[model samples]
Target: MPKLIEMMKPWQWMLYIFFWALFVTSIDRHDLATWPQFFVKFLSRIVQYTLSIIPSLYLIDYLRPIFKRDNPINVSMKILLLFAITSAVSATLVMLVMINTGWLVYERKAFVLNVLFNIVITVGFTLVFMLYFIRRYRELIALKQSFEHKLTAQNDLIKARIAPHFFFNTVNSLVSLIESNPPKAADLLQHVSALFRATFDGAREISFEEEVELCEHYLAIESSRLGDKLVVNWNLPDDDVMYDMVITALTLQSVLEKMLLNVVEMTTETIFIDITIEWHQHRVTITVTVQLPSKTLMIVHDLRRHVNFYIQAERLRAYFDQSADIQSDVTNEQIVTVINYPLYDVSI
Candidate 1:
């Protein structure tokens, strides 16, 4: 519960509360025959969960320091205090329900005992839920931290590589073009500025238009440096649809960058990098195929290892959950990388 507070958005917390309450209420009932019987209890539990859990969340968070104490006495005291708060809330709410639903008209002693038992069972369920949420929350925290760390590392790697890999060559190209082709040099400067802007951007999702724009800038700069040696072919969908989708900024560009960097020597007349994007069902499939260089030159390690395949897949998972994936097929003459991520209806 403490860990859950650290990560959950307000709506997400509500979802957890509502679902857990519904599950507990469903399992607690013995006579589950009629819709009327089930719904009355269902609505009540939902209300109780919504009301009781909201205040309890605040209190538990405030008392988290004490809850973490390892001393047995402190542990016992915390548990007692939490149970008392939750049970007290549950008892009050249930009494309101009984009064309204005519359950309070039953025999006095039996009613009191039944209410007591209900409070005990409900409070017991709350404690179990706390444990479950705590475990799940910690796991979530670990995964989020890992993803952030990887992004930071990759960002730093790009920063380190920029100067050595592209800047020097770009500078030389600018110097040569400054007098010979002033307009082309100005265009190169524009692309360079865009390159730097995209490179230093914090790890976040951006519209496909933004990513494509960045890729265009990058490809332009690379083309300037590589001259006629590099050729990029793009087969894409309509502008309206493409612009609506969002993906991790720099991710596809990184894959293209890796493809170029991995080319030690060109076996063919010109190195061709083909990018193809298609939509099927609710998912977008993007395939990048780069012609192979010489066997010996390409015998080298994959440059994409910096942002490994698994890391790319995880990035997609962050956006589309388990529906997204990134994979590659390596043939004798081409390395075909395929990335698939579901597009939400609204995104289209």
Candidate 2:
């Protein structure tokens, strides 16, 4: 339901409420004195119901996380209970409004089936919501699958990175450097530990500074192993404020690792990677361009690896949804990937 609420646009909400408001008004149109009264009632109900529904929408969204792990049976029962309570409260408020507005003559008899009328209205309103929920069924299922698949991919990638030639090579390098340069080796070991911790941190988001630090740690370890085979050119803003912005966890780490891995696998030649960070109109764009070797372009370009990396990268996209995305351009010479994401609610 949180996902559902998150996915729905403002226009969708307006359309949804407007449709149900008309349905509720129509149910009472038969009792109106004339067509003019019916129209008047519909307009009034639109204003009143829209105002009333806003709070309920917020309440439902607020309660979503609490009920997220509940069983289907419990969820269904809870939904029914909430609807009943909302209807009863709305009915009481409507009755009071009618009395004060001179729409109803105040009397005990005036109460006349108010609860029943509200029950009927609730049924119609609930249907409207159910219909909208049903309409988002495809997207909800896709999102669920993406999350499940992402978890599997992340675990697999983490396992591969943690227990491989790269990890072994870094360890080997650390061992040799321990006697030669104890301080440098210790720093390298710390970076390795921090890199591993960053990946498994279980954080949904982290500051841009942390992300950049992770990237540098990654490159440091890689530089130790690959030596002159890897070259990274960093282009960044002079302003420190941009680094205070936030990005989804591993948003840059995963992609940069994958890109570096792709190049490392193909050749022992010097691989050039340029990473640039820019801030414009309250948005942050990080661009990474990896230069491909002539031999690799002619010999092999593994599409499957790129596709897997893309799938993994898609996980971070869910954080901003429409406000952010990652894009890439592949050519004969290089693959240029740009990660564009917005920064808001940030204090620096």
Candidate 3:
């Protein structure tokens, strides 16, 4: 139960009493003689008041399970069907009681009028409850989403931090080259410094074309050290496509870095990384193919070390109201990572 509902407790009971008074007043059609009027109305309404309790329990019992259960309602078909049947029976009994107890005399027309009255009351109550519950449900959803967003932001921060740390470590590795290989090292250092600056200051998301340019810069730096060992194949669409969708900063860099770390590199042996981008209908897909190492191939485990991967996934799920999935598909002897996102009209 929510705090607002608890606060409404006194008011709910007051409404119950008010309705009873109204129901009695409708039947009496005249001013009561003091105590007699009050007592008669109260006692006559016992069955009607009793009618409220069962339906209230039924409603709460039905809705309460929505929070706890994850499976489809049809999975509990028997129970739900039973509940619906029981509710209808209870409603019929309440009507019969109201008719028999002289709360409302049952002329065929009067009975129809009372039924309509009951329906109006039921609908009014339902709408009131729906308004309150929907607001609370939406709040719960927002809180969950906000928690996930904060979690993802934290993970991205950690990943962003790791990127700098990785660059500096590589730069430190190249320091020995500067001392020993003079001119060769200076050229390498300049390229590394330039690429590092570009990466550090780049926007979160860039066009597919811009992303390819960034990738080129990245590969240039990597090639400087691991020459003749890295190859890239870009199969891109030539349509008037726009990478207008929002993406995290250095997301491709992160994915590529993860790929590079796992694959073995040697001067004589080469590794091929295939990147392809295309749009189908309302979705744009960026697919990367990398040859996995023979021993073990799990990028998620590595990612979990610094940035909370599960938390990040939850955040993405919250953001789009959809899931971001990573699956290793071995098709035509290639392992692929497909990142798919929706394409929106830039005009909008």
Note each model's CA RMSD in angstroms. 9.1, 5.7, 14.3
Residue-wise C-alpha lDDT for candidate 3, range 132-191, written one tens digit per residue: 665886888788767656755655564575477567756864786778877867766776
Mark the regions of model 3 whose C-alpha exceeds 4 Å error after superposition: 1-165, 173-210, 243-245, 266-268, 292-318, 330-333
* lDDT pick, better of 1 and 3: 1
Candidate 3 residue 258 C-alpha distance from true site, Å: 1.5
**Residue 41 CA error for candidate 2 (Å)?**
2.3
Write candidate 2's Cα lDDT for 1-348 as tens digits: 544445568788678668776887787776688887777666656665555566666777777777778885786567656676776676667667867888756666546576567666776666667666756876777887787677657656665765586677788999989999899898899899988887666536677788888889988987877789888898877656755677776677777877776776568778888999887877788888888887655233553336244543455565555657777777678878888876664564
Ranking by lDDT: 1, 2, 3
In each prediction, how many residue pairs overlap at the backbone (N, C-alpha, C within less than 3 A)?
0, 0, 0
- What C-alpha lDDT does candidate 1 achieve relative to the native structure? 0.73
Extract clashing residue pairs from model 3: none
Instruction: Give the least accurate 10-residue stretch of model 3, judged by summed lDDT.
Output: 303-312
Per-candidate Cα lDDT values, in order, are 0.73, 0.71, 0.56
Q: Give the TM-score of candidate 3.
A: 0.47
**Native-to-model Cα distance after best TM-score fit, residue 175 in candidate 2, in Å:** 3.7
Q: What's the lDDT for candidate 2?
A: 0.71
| Number of the top-ranking candidate, with TM-score as the measure | 2
Taking the tens digit of each residue's C-alpha lDDT, what string does model 1 give over 243-302?
A: 677888777887887776666223435788899988778788889998876534554245
